[model samples]
Target chain A: MKFLCGIALIALPAFTFYCWLLLDSETFLSLLQESIPIQTQYIGLSNRLLALVPGLIPIALLMRGAWHLRRLFGLFAVRAFFHEEIAQRLHGFAFMLVFSVLAKPVAGALSSAALTMNYPEGERSISVTIESGDLTTLFIGVIFLIIAWVLREAHQLSKENAEIV
Target chain B: MSILVNLDAMLAKRKKRSRELAEYVGITEQNISLLRTGRVRGIRFSTLDKICEFLECQPGDLLEYKSNVDLTQ
Candidate 1:
């Protein structure tokens, strides 16, 4: 449990930094051009920075998820298995993941629009993309949410059992 | 609340302390205290068996059902 907490502590910042770096990289622009129906050549530095604005939505959600995961691990490390906070943190992380997945298409559309904002007025486009990865994330998030609910039920049972002689 | 615990009376009749019964029953003194005061939700069958065996009494001697008792209280 301590090891997992340590890993989560490291992963939180690592993932956040990785996402920021990825969003700012040239590779991301090329990938965006391939996935989004937009002219990557017309995307200047200002447009690229503008495009990063939409990416922040998922990044923020993921960061919050990571924070909740770290806290949950911290509770486990202290042997607080049946604590209400454990279920709450798991629920928070799960919902953050679910919201991040849901925000993907909206962010993608906004990013595409931001990227094409500098283009000729008639040439600008707004495109929404949904990949298989988003569906997978949503599925996992729902599973975690169910687990959190079960954990809460288990906590209640534990409390009741503790009151018994 | 209708199911009343008479553990205190049984323990007194048996001339045994709560600490001694707690040790023999493999439970905490705090739990014994709760049982004696009728503050517990319920007693496990194994624990009840241990207590009855230690006190040489039946389950009925340690518990009673009172229909007129105010459950909420």
Candidate 2:
């Protein structure tokens, strides 16, 4: 699990950079166009790349959350589930995920604004898209925070129990 | 904070070492030291019973309560 997260952490930035390159470099654009059907009207390279930033912001947050999640899993793998650090890492991951989920609308707005920035004033359009499925990810993040709180209480009890002897 | 463990005095009066008491009670000497120094949170009934039996003393002889007083002094 840790290995997979590490690989993903590395892969996301690389993939984002590749996409950025595709927006500018004809070579990567041709490669992507060959494999994927390009249905959208082609916008200016700078506008497309700028629009991509807001979407990439959420991915970056996810990468950070995944790093902490990986650490939590690593602790569990070593049977350190009761350690105080586990609760901290779990909470951090949860908050990051929650923030990422909540920022989705803002990201959409930013992406739209970036895309339409240079268009003639009357012609500019502001677009925002929402997908209902993202709520499930928000709920999962909340659940992680709840579990972390429970673990914190358990950790305190464990400490008291240890001192009993 | 007023509750105190008198295990050290009990062990002294019984002319027993903490190590011997720990062995007789089936616990580690480090725990015996903790109990003697009043550093532990609490003791298990089984462990308390063993200590009482091994020391040939009542539980009261091993623990006492005093009014809370200024600890800084």
List the global CA lDDT of all models.
0.82, 0.80
Colliding residue pairs in candidate 1: none
What TM-score does chain A of each model score against the native chain A?
A: 0.82, 0.82
TM-score of candidate 2 against the unseen true structure? 0.85
DockQ of all predictions against the true structure, Cα-based: 0.82, 0.83
TM-score of chain B of each: 0.89, 0.90
Q: Scored by Cα lDDT, where does model 1 land?
A: 0.82
Best by TM-score: 2
Model 1 TM-score, all chains together:
0.81
